[model samples]
Target: MCCYVGCVSETAIESIRRSTRVMLLFTELTAVLPIFFLLQERRPWAVLGLLMAGVVAIIVIRVRGTLLRLRGLWEPYSYARVYGLVAAAMGIAVLAAVTGSQTGVFTAILVGITASEFFVARPLGVASRHVGIVVALQSAAFWIVVVSTGHGDMVGPTLIGTIIMTSGLAYSVGLTYRWWEGVLKLEQARRDAAELATTRERLRLAEDLHDILGHALEVVSLKSELAVRLTDPEKSKAEMIEVQRLARNALRDVRALAHGNRRTDFGTELTGARGLLDSAGIACDFDADPTALTTSERDLFGRVLREAMTNALRHADPRSCTVSLAVTPDQATLRIVNDGVAPLQRDGEGSGLAGLARRVEASGGSFTARAVEPASFEVIASLPR
Candidate 1:
């Protein structure tokens, strides 16, 4: 198993299946070697026929059980059928003991013990332990029968050594199967987690699109309707111009959202915020300097500015809004202040603001949003230089 770990390019599950199949083939050949040697000794045709039949049956059953288990299709009936074949092989070994053929008895015992390897294919820990105990018991029974029935010529430490070797091989193979199962399960869990994270990101993007485009479209609709009701051509023209601007902004935002490129430049956002505030009939005061900030700092502060502007437009009845940016030797700061603070209608912050705060903190910064005065709402974000 260790030798094959780096020999394949398949996935974990496929690798496990390939390795288990190789192990089964190796064990099958070794189990049949003893019978092949006994035939070289000119054993009786009847004895060879019976021993060959039992060996073939045991191999077929083990192969079938191993395939089913690897495909995760093993059931109670399959398990029972394999164990029954093992019993028949053990019966053959008892017959060999009665017939005074030491080689046949040893081969039968080896095949029966190898059959227990199929039981270890089950995924259950308790079942593997039980199968191991049963194999040990069967080996002990074989040794006792071989010694008691005057077949003691080969019943010294050599007999005990063979039993130990077979039992150890079976146990090691079972443990390796269990270890592979655990690795495959862990790989499956990681894949599931990755898929879940992708799903959540998709949902988040949907929500962001709704929040951005929905607000812009609603404002466009309201302003266009107002322009329609106006009797003066000049006022109607002005309102239509504002509506056009809003439409273009919405389209740009949609493109950015679709491409997963939402990062904003601080200077661009400040200019856009001033335009939006003026178009909405609110006085705008903008103050920012980008010469001292790094690209990451600008991007972070830009997102904060955008979110604050969005919240102010949607949730406040402000007469004026102010955006100010300042950079010192150690840090850079952004503050958005608006008059006419609305009453708090929710107990918690919105996801947009929460996400902004996380971004700010992730870049070694700080964010705060609160009503700084009875009529003024303020948002402050600070980042290290």
Candidate 2:
């Protein structure tokens, strides 16, 4: 079977993941920069708390990477640690704000923004709502303290900047996953189309010795049986003579099939139909005695059977089907009766029948497809004998 080969390369997907991870972590560590501006304004312990928040951030990143590698897709293990550091940063912001320092307000906003990003790469699912509420409360408290200390001018710009930064980090990875899923679906559809083309080619080249000899051999068996049961010796000898003629004809057809002359064979089509139905858990019954047909007629009717079988597999969930051949001295008829036809769909359902009907009519034959009952459909083709 053929398969599609072109797809988004593994190198391209890995590159996207690495670039987004680096950018997100870089933003998270930028919180400690405000401590530089506050070197002389705050006590040493207050400065140490801001420095410890940065260290906790680096440790949180290492843990996230470890969890992603070990479990591939698991909940974050650093929940308690991430928020604990956010709360500690907010506490320090309150103390620094009492001195009416403007730099201390910026430090609180940066630390809150940094702590929120650790959960952005892979969100906490439903727990993320709680994350937003906790951050919103911390941000409101920081603004309130700055306003009370007569440092209200820094409120608007600082608040707006942090919100924009937080929103960008949150949506980046989710957008990446959406891109990944859409590419995979298109790749799978390409592979299915390729395999279908290959299967049609194989079916066209499937002529073999067994299929070439099938009809003639059945005729020989019937003649031999009749000869064995006859009481008149002369009649028995005549039947054996006819049996020898069929055996010779079978040998001639086998040689022709080997030379790539015959395009279709009834025995080959019959075998393929049986295998398809059996694999799908459908019970199929083929008639034991088939009407004798000319070589060209056999080829034509074999194609009809193949087309009918293909439609059945694709459109219906059938439980049982019967394939039979009938003769009326003037015409030879092939009929397929199948159960489990879907009742409501008329558009494009059994749509190939229209083209197949044209094929049958061009060869001085008639074709029809009709519903026999609520859950049954029948197809019939007749050619002049």
Candidate 3:
């Protein structure tokens, strides 16, 4: 049924649910039987035995399918009928207690307690509070009747049994309900976690496509513009051919990415970034040692550099940019700073920076991008070594 999670078996959940329901119902059905002798004692007061039997009958009917809603066993599911029946049973028990002056009403009080605990309390959570109240009422009934009607000899056993049954009922009912509720909560959380993972992966892929296509198009623009200005036919044709090759490569990369087999190569991206910047007449200062970074860190920093360089070229008039890498004993940090960082870039109006932050934090790292004073923007990412 996948009731708990993807890997959990339907049989396991069914077994747990069935066993708990059976135990709870079994205890509930036998709740009044423990004090049978007390109820049998001198029904001469006013046919209290008949009333006791009536209470038991009503509760049995009410409890027949007390968990009907849980199993979806009912065709047109409803609790109105069960609620009315239990109410009637509680009323009868209450009436018997009020009128049975000399007879002990402890059994009647137990009837009320079980009805409230099982039928009302388990579903609505309101009747559970009455467990203690009715138990106290049962004790009062025992003491008052025992002294006047002479159940004094049966005092020790009756009191002991009442104490055991009430305590056990309260504890067992509550424990099972809370355990069931916890299982449901854990199931919901598992589903939410899976959905969140899938959504984040989609966002990551979108960011990758943005980095890939954004830079490719930017370089194509630059090469096409340079080709327009060239007077030599051969050089202009060569630049146009280079632009075509770059477009084809970008299209191939998009296909590879869609196939899910594409991996980031830091060296290839860095070389491409240098060419794009040179073509744009932007001088870049890059100080990096590739050996210090792991494969994943290299991929992450490569994306960082690509996004930063693309933003510099696309959004600003820039003559200079700097890309720096620093590795310490405990951490590796990458920083990309450019002088022509536009004012609009200060407050990120796009998902690129946000996606980078999500990726870095998911990998137990940190990322930040903010515009510095004097038209400069800085992007920094750090990972634990």
Q: Against the true structure, whose TM-score is highest? A: 3
Stretches of candidate 2 off by over 4 Å are: 1-42, 46-71, 74-102, 108-135, 157-385
Top model number, lDDT: 1
TM-score of every model versus the real structure? 0.70, 0.42, 0.74
Error of 3 at 271 (Å): 0.8
Residue-wise lDDT of candidate 3 within 31-62, one digit each (tens)?
56524644555545455656666666765654
Local lDDT at 46 for model 2: 56
Which digits, one per residue and each the tens of the lDDT, describe model 2 over residues 2-42? 23333544565456546554554554445545556456465
lDDT of 1 by residue, 46-133 (tens): 9768867876777676566556755655343465664676567666665555554445545544534555556454655655665665
Instruction: Give the count of colliding residue pairs in each prediction.
Output: 0, 0, 0
* Model 1: colliding residue pairs: none
Ranked candidates (TM-score, high to low): 3, 1, 2
